[model samples]
Target chain A: MSILVIAEHDNKELNPATLKTLTAAQAMGDDIHVLVAGEGCAAVADQVAKAAGVAKVLCADHAAYGHQLAENISALVVSLAKDYSHVVAPATTTGKNFMPRVAVLLDVAQVSDIISVESADTFRRPIYAGNAIATVKSDESIKVITVRATAFDAVAAEGGSASVDALDAVFESDKVRYVAEQVAASERPDLSSARVVISGGRGMQNGENFALLEKVADKLGAAIGASRAAVDAGFVPNDMQVGQTGKIVAPELYIAVGISGAIQHLAGMKDSKVIVAINKDEEAPIFQVADYGLVADLFDALPELENALS
Target chain B: MKILVAVKRVIDYNVKVRVKADQSDVDLSNVKMALNPFCEIAVEEAVRLKEKGTAEEVVVVSIGPKACQEQIRTALALGADRGIHIETDTMPDSLAVAKLLHKVVDEEQPQLVILGKQAIDSDNNQTGQMLSALTDMPQGTFASEVQVDGDKVNVTREVDGGLQTIELTLPAIVTTDLRLNEPRYASLPNIMKAKRKPLDVKTPESLGVELGSKVSVLKVEAPAERSAGVKVADIAELVDKLKNEAKVL
Candidate 1:
């Protein structure tokens, strides 16, 4: 059985999450084909060719694919779905946006945000905001899944040639049209792809205090995150929020500052390998899951921590 | 323009869900149920569109057990004109739900369809997209802002990285995000009047749609409990442990 992985990338660089998807793809079997669809993603196709265990790379470069609109991508994926037994993509916004369409077109139920591979057609996914996990078995002919990228290791990039094939599928536009995109500009790693993340909570007080998190994140080379309370309070953008309603992150190290850990927030990041929490409240819920807890004001603690690291 | 808003019944968000001892599913013996919070936002958005004179009719629909009609009445209480309950005991898979919705769309032909991004109970954010694909219509998922202009609708979606704006023609599907709008509580008069609103109930057989299960649950288990860690006395010791012992920083 072969697995088809859709590569996530801009025209310039392949997202690191794509490699993680390859890891899950490899677990299914050795014959893994990566499909790179974009306006001008020949370089991305070349990069995927170097990834280990990749049998082939299919490149579908067309103007309609520049923004990866759900309509066009779903059409392309539906055409490609005929040749593969399993189709996989990282459970990022892009993958979640389009995979369901592919599943409906193919008449299969899409397995979403899977955290573990039980078997070829079985998987484990979080339910009730990660309060519980449900093991599911697919009864359909074709298995469509979106893997949680952080749960798997990224396949190593080694020199190899994956035969590139150009798919000849007609582009059909839907009612949706891409108007514009404004990507958040950050020097730190992207949260979804980052192995280490540092998040702030309401304990930080306001948006200006987020700079403290940026400094510590710079020291550890980690991505900055926030709790739902912080995001709701306007201390950070909603994209930076991590919780049941926000992004689910499982990094190597997760440091939470000034955040009282609510159950919803814990559901998102409790799976991190190492957790450290700094909160003035002694009974904050975050301390329950933290491997290291510090009961102190983040205002005084942040500078000291940064200086010590420096 | 006429609008259709879909809602789901789920465990109230405030209640903590416990896994059954057998691990087959959650223990829902006597737990209170409420309208899915996100779906309430969807209903509120549709009602607001009508109140703002952009929509002439707002119809709500829910596909679940007969008891789900309570949620439909709640939607009506929130200003929805009417409701259609596709009664079923089993939770249909996303593809099946989309198919049933497609049948409804064929019959109703509403100008727009809005739904919660995903149900809190299943947390599968697929029905909206699947419905869009099945109908070959445009979809704006996880929308934070929506503006209607003549024949086109502009939506700002809440994506992981940031926000993205997409423009789609009418007769499209739009799933609401957290920031889309604050759902309003039903007033006393509206709650009393909701008892009089028209509600049509039909079974899966009556709808002539096959409710098939594509994926089956094998087991359910609670997440591993995280043990509490040591609390450092001060910043000096905390920094020392992080750098010297933990070696993460």
Candidate 2:
């Protein structure tokens, strides 16, 4: 049986998470193909072609596929469903948004936010804000899944050449249309792709205080993140939020600042390889899971920490 | 306009969940159950719309065990006019939940359906979108703001980048985010009044739908524990330790 992966990327560059999904797909026995569906997305197709273990690249280029609308993408995926036994995508906003639609269209169930592949049908995923892990097995003939990119290694892009093929599937545009898009321009790495992340919580107090985190993050070449409390307190944008309601991230190093480790917040970043908590509250719950704990006023320690990094 | 709100019963957010020793599932023995936080927001949003005289009726639906009727009653106390509980012992897959809700939507004939972005229990943010696709209804997910006009709804959604505003016609699905609104607690008087409110309980089998299992649980396990680090005495020592010992900097 063959596996099909949906490649995520901007038109100019492929997201590294695509390779992680490829690694998961490789575990299903390596007869894999990647689908790069977008308008004028040949560059993404080309990038997918160079990824290891990719047997072929199916490019669906059309004006209707520009926005990667769930409706159209679901239709395309359903059309491709018959050819593959398994389908995988990185559990990003885009993947999560569309994979369920495809699942419904194909009359199958989707395993969302899978952390590990137990078998062809069974998988491991977090439940109750990462407080519990559930291993699920699907009995359906076609397995649709969204893989957590952080749990798997990204496949190397060397020693393989993938043949590119143009999909002839017709687009079925629906009510959803492409709207104006806005992207945050940050010097730090993207939060989902970052191996290291330093997040500030309400402990930082104000937006300007986040500069302390920026300094430490810059020194480590890490992404800057925030707790929902910090975002709700207007200390940072919602995009920086790392929690159950926000983005679930798993970086190599996760440093939580001034943030009381709420269960919801821990549910998101607790999967990080190394956790460091710098909160003055000695009884803060974050310390329970933190590898490194410091009971200090973040305001006082932040400047000193920044200077030390310099 | 008729509005539909989907609710879920989950362990109270404040309660610390414990995994069973066998790694099969979480221990729910004496844990207090409450309506999901996001679902509370969704119900509150619907209630506000009805309070403004914009919505003709607010119908709350939940798909879970028979005990979920308590969550529906909770929603009734919060101001929903009626409740529909698709009783089942096991939690169905997201697609199955959406299908069951679609069946309810077809019967209720509501113009709008609002749901929590994801249930706190499964953390699978799929039901709302799946329902939208199943019913071919337009969806506005992770909505922070929702405004209903004559036949269209303007929704401000929370995206990774920032807030995104979208407009969709009637018969749409909207999922709530955390900052949508502060949910009000049910007063004692309201709780008494909710007892008199009508709550209809029906089995999925009675609805002529076979709740099929999609995914099966193999095991449950606690995440790996992190080793505790040393607590330094001062900033100078902390910095020196971080630089020379920890080597993170």
Give the best candidate by lDDT: 1
lDDT (tens digit, per residue) of candidate 2 on B1-249 = 899999999999889889999887899889999999999999999999999999989999998988889999999999898888888998887888988998998999899999998888888889988998899988888888888888888887776656667677788899998888988989999989988988888888877778877677888888766556666666677666655766655
Provide the lowest-lDDT 10-residue window in model 1 chain A: A167-176
Per-residue C-alpha lDDT of model 1 across residues A38-82, encoded as one tens digit per residue = 988899999999998899999999878888889999889888888
TM-score of each predicted structure versus truth = 0.98, 0.95
RMSD of 1: 1.2
Reference-based lDDT, residue A146, model 1: 94
TM-score of chain A taken by itself, candidate 2:
0.97
Candidate DockQ scores, in order: 0.84, 0.60
RMSD of each: 1.2, 2.0
Report model 1's TM-score to 2 decimal places. Answer: 0.98
- Per-residue C-alpha lDDT of model 2 across residues A246-277, encoded as one tens digit per residue: 88888877889998988889878887877888
